[model samples]
Structures are given as C-alpha cells and as structure tokens.
Target: MSVDTIYKVILYPFITESIASLKAMTNLQGTAGDPFIDNVDDFRFKGYAVCSDVTGNLDGVIMMHHYPETAIAIGNSVCEKMFDEKYEHTEITEELSNALAEWGNTIVGRSTDLHGRYSLEYNFSSPYFVHDVSDMAKYLAGVTEVVTVPITVEGVGRYYFNLLVRSVDYQQVGIKREESRGIENTHTTTLETSSKILLVDDSAMIRKALKRYLAQLGYHNVIEADDGASAVTMVASESPDFMFMDVVMGEVNGDEALRQIRAAGSNVPIVMLSSVTDKVLVDKCKDLGISGFIFKPIQADSGAEIIKDYLKIA
Candidate 1:
C-alpha cells in the first residue's frame, strides 16, 4: 500500500473496540480520516499500523515497535476468546504473552520489507506498558529516534487480513551513511547478559563490518579470530559466548572448524555463516549440529536477530 494511503482507523468495529480499550480511550468508530488511537494525540487509525510523530520529536530510542502478531495468534486460539471453550477465562495472560512474542518474531520479519529508510534492528525485550499517551515519549526517553508502526488486524473471519505497517513515516527517514544505508543512527538495546562474542572469518572486510554491527547492537565485548585454528583456541581459552564461522578459508573451512569445536565439548551456539548456498555442503553442517545458518551478505540487523533468537538472549 502507498505510504500516504495508510492511515490510522479501521473500517471494522471489533478491531476498533479493542484499539479503544487498549488505548483506554472512549469508544471509537473510526472509519475514514483519523479514528481513535493510543499513544499520541496526533495518531489516528486507518486500517492497520499507527504512524505518527505527534510531538515533533524524532530523536532517541524511536519505538518503531509492533506486537500485533499477538492479535493474529490469539484470533486463532481455541479459547472462549477464540473458539468459545467452556468457563472462558479466569486467566488468559500466559497465552497472550506467548502470542505477543510470536507476534514480535513475525512482525520483525515483515518489517524487512519497509527497511528502506532505516534498519529496524532489535530483539523483543521487556516492553514497558505505557497507559498514558502523554507518557509514551517519556517511556522512550533515552536512546535515539522513535518510530511506531501499529500493525492492526482488521475484520473478523477464519483468517484476518493483516496490515503490518498501518502507518510509516510520511517523510523519508533522514539518513546519511558511508556504507549501505536505511538505518537509524542510534538504536541500543539493554543487554542483560555479559558474554564474549568470537567472530571467525578470514576476510578482513566482513570481520570489520560485523564487529561494528555487534557494537551497534549493544554487544560491548566481541573478539575476532582470523582462522579456524585460532578460533578453536578461543573456544577452549576464551570460552566465548558464541561463534560466527565463515564456511570457506585458505587453511581450514568452517566444516572442519565446526567438527573440531563440537569434539572439544563446547556447546556454545555455533552459527555457520557462509556465502556457499550449495545444498550438499549446507546439509553437512546441519549434521554437525550448527546452531544456526545464515547466508553471506548478512544485514547487520538480521545477523543480530539470528544470534539473539537462537541464543534466547534476554
């Protein structure tokens, strides 16, 4: 859909009712130009996705956040809320939480489509519930930049239609960079765990780019080892948090390095990162217990996500 065509208001009543309740505002029957919305005074609803910069402040920890995957999952759930099971909810919080996490996973993937202006890079961290719309700006006080897209599910049926980015930036996200662009200058998540990252790759270019990306993801400590043998040494001595292994190298390929590491009793997540898409070679790594596999030319955001999700970092 055109960015201008996407607004903040749903044609369906069921969706509108929930949006009103979620925002704790008066009952809204928003159909056309700006229906009821939560968070900011300027934000209204169209179909899905809520996009606005109501306060005219676009710096520090922009919350381009989406958790509507919960709405989709819960919509299909076989509960009183879903299929009308017996006794209908003394509690449904656990299911809702799981639904929310799944929503984050799917929405993050869908966002890759709109990452033209800025890289939407982040893991699903503990969310701060802000009831008051005025306090949303306060909730995202520190950090840099705030972009919020409300992925709204409109209509009720066997399968609801999803609008992942109901509203995106009306204007281009101000971006200027040396390399490939389309990313906010600053987005730092609070990393609760302190684990060392060992990046194993022969290419200097890949290593440098990855190291910078890790730092951008708020991973302060990352150690880079050039070859598989050194990486194996780090596995034993450094006891690193995780390893990113490049598949092909002059002396030893990733396959050899992986088997050696596994033999050494290091169960740390080992992700085989390679440009080689050959099906047979890829399968071999799978047999050796590679924690994750990502192709070469990995985007900074995508790489960080594989790491966070596979490791379940808090």
Candidate 2:
C-alpha cells in the first residue's frame, strides 16, 4: 500500500460522532496532530494495539494503535452512541473491549476490501487487542517498512494506524490508473425542485456532510433527525421523498425505526447507512422494506448515484 489508500480507509470508519467532535475542537484550538506521517523509527510504547494478519498478494499485519486514554475515550463514545450509556475510563470492561475489537475488525476488513478492488487480494485475521506496545513491536520485528497514520482525537491524545506489508508492484497487480484517483467527485442529477429528503443520524458531522452532499447534487429541501425515534417523527411530518438512515443510534436503532415507520403504512423510499457489515441485520432490513443500503462514511459520488438510481431521479 499506498499512503493515500490507507488514509481513505481510516477516514471513513474511524471518524464517528465523538471523533468528529474532537477533530472540530482540535481545529478550533489549533492543536491538531499532523496528518498521516511515516515515522517507524520513533515508535514508542504507549498504548493499546489491535493486531490482525493480512494474507494474499500483499502479505503482512495491520495494527491500530491508540493511547490508553484515546482507546478508552473512543470506547466510551461508541457505547454511548450505540447503547445510550456513559462509561468512564476506569470502567474498561470486557463488553467495551469486545466492542473495540469489533470496530477494529470492521475498519481492517473494509481496508482490505479497498485493496482487493485494486486487484491486491487480501484477507484479514480476527483482531487481537493488546495493552502493551512491546507485543505489537515483537509481532513486526522482521518487517522493514511500516506506514503510520497519526489521528488526533481532541479529548483523548493521538491514535496511530500502522501497516507493515511486503513490497509489491502496483502495475503488476492490475491496479487501474483511474482507480488510484482516490474519492471521486459527486455527480449532479436533475430532480424536481420540490423534492424533499430526510437525513437521520446521531452524528452532527455526518448529518452535515450528507446535507452538503445533497446540496451539491441539487437537492436542498433536506431535513435532519438525530436518532431513530426522531427520524420516525420526521418521516411522518416531513413526508420526505427519500430518507437516509444510520443503522447505529441511541434508543431506537435504524431497524426499529424502519419497523415502526412501515407498521404505520408509510411507503417512503429509505436507505440504510452503516459502517459495519452484518448479514443478519441487512436481511432484517430488507424484510422491513428498506429500499437500499449505503455504507458509511458515505462517498459523495456513490451516494448521489444511490439516490438517482433508487429514487428514479433524472
């Protein structure tokens, strides 16, 4: 891998509600950490490392390293978003650890998929979390080059992403020239000026980003809802032509919201948004009558296409 590819993967999955809030604070305080910089020699022992093996055309191990405080902060934030509960740093229970590990797996697995699309077939092992950095260093003893991307979460310190992989020829792997262009620009589609759209998510950053994206695509009458219960109310009152809902939220999740909406006999087109892949939940959504699924962090171009295709917009 390329540094840009790694950065794109990390940006989408890790930048949750709490992380986005921290990033905004860092921007205002002028204490933001450096963007993904390579510094393998200065790697010091200070945090938790979630390690996973990568196998295929490019063989190596991927590690997500976060300072203990950062890990605890992220874990607590995730718990609050998912379960509507607060957890202190001292309450680092197995439940929190498992949640963190699952998060790690989702990020690594999605990164692997990005690599695979470039013809670099890769598979990741189950994530293993360790509190000591020495264990992570030992695992990468023989690896020569490692790519480190440092992310600064305001309340917590900096978190790092380390990738240790064997060298490979990008051209030989069949990566296309256009595929390396990173994220594509959003495509504008013609739609009725009166068309209404509803965005449902707990994260302010995500909701804002989606609204901006919709504005770019010529859809301005967009309404926002913070959680599932609120989303249900918006669907009834706003009567939007389309809705994009986040799967994970406090109180009522996206699934239950859809259930309630359908139970009330509303036939508005709905798309489910999520960062993780869960077949059972996806099948359940289909049963609940969701029109489509969009994975987070939503790409402008792809998201616009989903709206155009699913809603039959010109």
How many pairs of residues collide in each model?
25, 0
Tens digits of lDDT, candidate 1, 1-314: 23223322111222332343222211112222232223333432221122222222122221323234433333233222211233223332545433333232222222322232243332222222222355544443342221232334334222121222222334334332112211111213433446688899876545765676666567768888888888888899989877778876657778898889889887876767664344566678877876666654443335455445444322
Candidate 2 structure quality by residue, lDDT tens digits, 1-314:
55666444432333332243332212211132333545556656556777767666556666777777777777665544433345565655766675565456446544444444544445666556778645756765666557665666555667776666554333333222111212111323444646898889876656765676677668899889989999899888879887889877767989999999999999886878775445567779888877667654443334455445444322
Q: Cα lDDT of all candidates, in order? A: 0.44, 0.61
For candidate 1, what is the lDDT? Answer: 0.44
Off by over 4 Å in 1: 1-193, 300-314
Candidate 1 — worst ten consecutive residues by lDDT sum?
A: 178-187
Pairs clashing within candidate 2: none
| Best lDDT among the predictions, by candidate number | 2
Taking all chains together, the TM-score of candidate 1 against the true structure is 0.38
lDDT for 259 (candidate 1):
88
